[model samples]
Target chain A: MPATLAEKILQQHCDEQITGPGQIVRCRLSLVLANDITAPLAIKSFKKMGAAGVFDKDKVTIVADHFTPNKDIESAEQVKVCREFAKEMGITHYFEGGNVGVEHALLPELGLVGPGDVVIGADSHTCTYGGLGAFATGMGSTDVAAGMALGETWFKVPPTIQVILTGELRQWVGAKDLMLALIGTIGVSGALYKALEFVGPLASTLSVEGRMTMSNMAIEAGGKVGLFAADDKTLAYAAAHGRKGDKAIAADAGAAYERVVTIDATGMEPQIACPHLPDNVKPVSAVAGLKVDQAVIGSCTNGRIEDLREAAAILKGRKVSKDVRTIILPATPNIWRQALAEGLIETFMDAGCIVGPATCGPCLGGHMGILAGGERAIATTNRNFKGRMGSLESEVYLSGPAAAAAAAIAGEIIDPAKV
Target chain B: MYHGTAHTVGAHIDTDAIIPARFLVTTDPAELGANCMEGLEAGWIKKVKNGDIMVAGENFGCGSSREHAPVALLGAGIPVVIAHSFARIFYRNGFNMGLVLLEIGDDVSKIHDGDELKVDADTGVINNVTTGQTIQCKPVPPFMKGILDKGGLIPYVQDRLAERA
Candidate 1:
């Protein structure tokens, strides 16, 4: 039987031969990840289980990214727990403050994950690695602790949903717009307990960074994994990251799919996920001139070098509106350093934007740019559920980097075509 | 088997609403219980008592992979969560924390807020005592049931490691 990309990876990891979907199989994990918020609990579970040591010190990665540079004394204590555990266990990939970046963005850059591997993290966005053709999913702290101790976990194989993309995206519209449009069409729970496989012409053309942006939000649609077949772009990306081993993984031509949906990407306008729900999407034209008190361009969703460059292009010679405060955060330390070398940081600062460190602070209302009562913000981050970035009285509009930059200048949601 | 009053909510009740980020600094279950659902329905914590069931629409516990979301509810004496569907991570987290969940589909609408329900985990049955209607839910898989029997993944792993030794 021909297998899908997800099936092929699962079969490779499964301890015994598997028949099909819904079969429980034990999978050997290539990587296990947790951040400050989730790692402390995982560590406690590890100790309680009487596990003498991590199954493989090299396979476990812990980073202090969320609530880092500690938001409060309690947060400070949490980081301390993770730090002590990492030191005692001699975990190879532990990242401390000032060195930490969003785990989803930083892991691939460090060549810790690659195609045809099964990975799990205690953070939901762990699916981002699917851009590199890996089968990665998020689990709870206890599950992660078991994986850390045993080096293997169980999974019930999921059916696959094929999403075929055709035609070229319009200018100024990027992956963020494409993803928002997809969620809107499918509703929030459309892909519950299923795998979403991206294929066709447009999928092959998307940059790895763009693929990451799409895969990172797979959870938003209630998907198990959002996958793109490893092609030339994927191989080149892994090679650039210094990954040297196997070539990219691809599905058999005759692989079966539970359902197929085709999306035409031509002339699609920059889209926005309105306040309260990610699937509540509309084109920028529909909500034009809606005032914004703040604008943010960062998070694992769009906080890459390419995203920063796109925002920098829009804000190069323009000043932000006096009523709006703009903030830019590069997703990883490498991206931040590269942005500095390219003068993108200076461009943002000269345009009246505040540049923050590589942390997930403002994205989850952890800190940094939280909103006040009745405030509104345009951001490149995922999730705009009520009170997602601050007070329940506040609102958030989700958009791509370029649209967020343009909104900062106009102090309102604006069509990037007009910028 | 257990019986309780059902407290209902709509779809996409996210983890941020279950236990908001502002209160995520601590891992203490009691602290989390006090703030659970505080973001969505203030004073909900005060109303909840021991042995209540939470019934929700599709995609319950969506957003973020915070186990604290389920911990908060469990701490507030919510031992079971019944929904039309759940986000994948949350489903696994609930079991790992020894919190029971039943996926009852459209039958969820038949049970109203404050209605009495008697849930039987072994047989996958939820009986609406108030309306006298019985709904069939999908049974938990054998492996997951084994973990829950051991009171979550930690003890399950401990037992397995002991067997190996």
Candidate 2:
């Protein structure tokens, strides 16, 4: 049977030919991840299984980013468990505290992940690794522990739904626009349990950073993983990051697709997924000029150095709107340090933006920027599902960092192009 | 072990609601389960009982490939989860973690919390022990049944793959 890119990959890694959905196959995962929150659990499970050591120290990556400064005693204690496991397991790519940023961002920046690999993280957004053209998704601690105990996993092969992007994006219509526009067309559950195999000429045009922004939010669209076919651009990105690995591979040109949706970027204006649901998308014009209480620019999705640079450029010399509280959080401490060295931090501070520690705070309602009743904030994070950011009634508008910065200045939904 | 009647929710009960991303930092499944539904419908934890059934809407375990989701639920003593559908990963994770997941159609709405239920694993029938009502759920596939019968996916896979040798 002709199979989609996702099916083809799953079969190759499996011991047999997997035909339909829900057929379990013992397959090999290319990458496995754990952080402070998940590592402790994985380690606990490992102890229960009486596992001697991790299956392959190099395949598993443990990163410490969620509680960078060790927010509380619990977070501080979580980091301790992760560190001890890294030492005991002899893990190769263990990222120590403060040396890393968001687990998703820091991995690629450090050149540890690459194309065609099946990456799994204990964190939900581990799907972010799909930006590298791999089958990366999130998992739980026992699963991570199993991966450590035995460097393999079982998966039910999923069907592939193709997303073809054509036409050039208009000015200020960045990757965030593409994702929001997609969610607009395909409701939140439209792509549920399907692998999003992004294709077409326009897909190639997206910069690595931009592609990461799109793939990071695949969860919001209810897809298992968003995949890119490895090409020259991916290879160049791999080289630029100094990743030493086999060359990446693209999908066969005639790969089968269960469904296909074409997005004309030129037709898309700036978009905003309304609060409470990522698929509740509309043209920014529809929601523009509305009052906003906060604007956040950071997260594994758009909190890269490049994202910071773009945001600082917009925020420089501009005062944050009196009614809007602007917050900037670098994805990782490394990105934070680099931004400070490059003066981006100073530029944001001069613009009256409040900087936050390198953790998922307001994005997941962990802390740092919880909203009050009826408050609304524009953020660059992935999901805006109800109560995802703060108050169930509080609205969260998802966008790129540029739009977030611009909105902070205007105190409403201001298009970056206009700013 | 679970002690009481099962409660049901609609399909697509996502991992974010079952166990939010904020709790991904810790691996202790029990601790994570405590805050599982705080992000979704707060105070849902108090309504559950050990061994209670959870009937849900479509696409249960719909978000994140996180394994903590099923672990949290299983550790919370949720004996079985019946939904219109289950997300691919969560379905696998639940079975792998020894949690029972039944795919019944919209009939899941027929079952409610505090209804004494008797589940026949061999027959795949949920009897409302209190109301004498019965809902049909998909029979567990033989392979998955073997996995569940043996505790979880890892042990099942380990045994099956090892036997092949």
Tens-place lDDT digits, model 2, residues A74-96: 77888888888899889898876
Model 2 chain A worst lDDT run, 10 consecutive residues: A244-253
lDDT (tens digit, per residue) of candidate 1 on A281-384: 99999999999999989999999999999999999999999999898989899999999999999999999999999899989999999999899999999999
lDDT by residue for model 1 over B90-142, one digit each (tens)?
A: 99999888788999888899999999999997788999999999999988888
Candidate with maximal lDDT: 1
Q: Report the TM-score of the second chain of model 2 against its true counterpart.
A: 0.86
Indicate which candidate wins on TM-score: 1
Top DockQ hit: 1
lDDT per model vs. reference? 0.90, 0.77
Residue B76 CA displacement from its true place in model 1, Å: 1.2
In the order shown, the candidates' DockQ scores are 0.82, 0.43
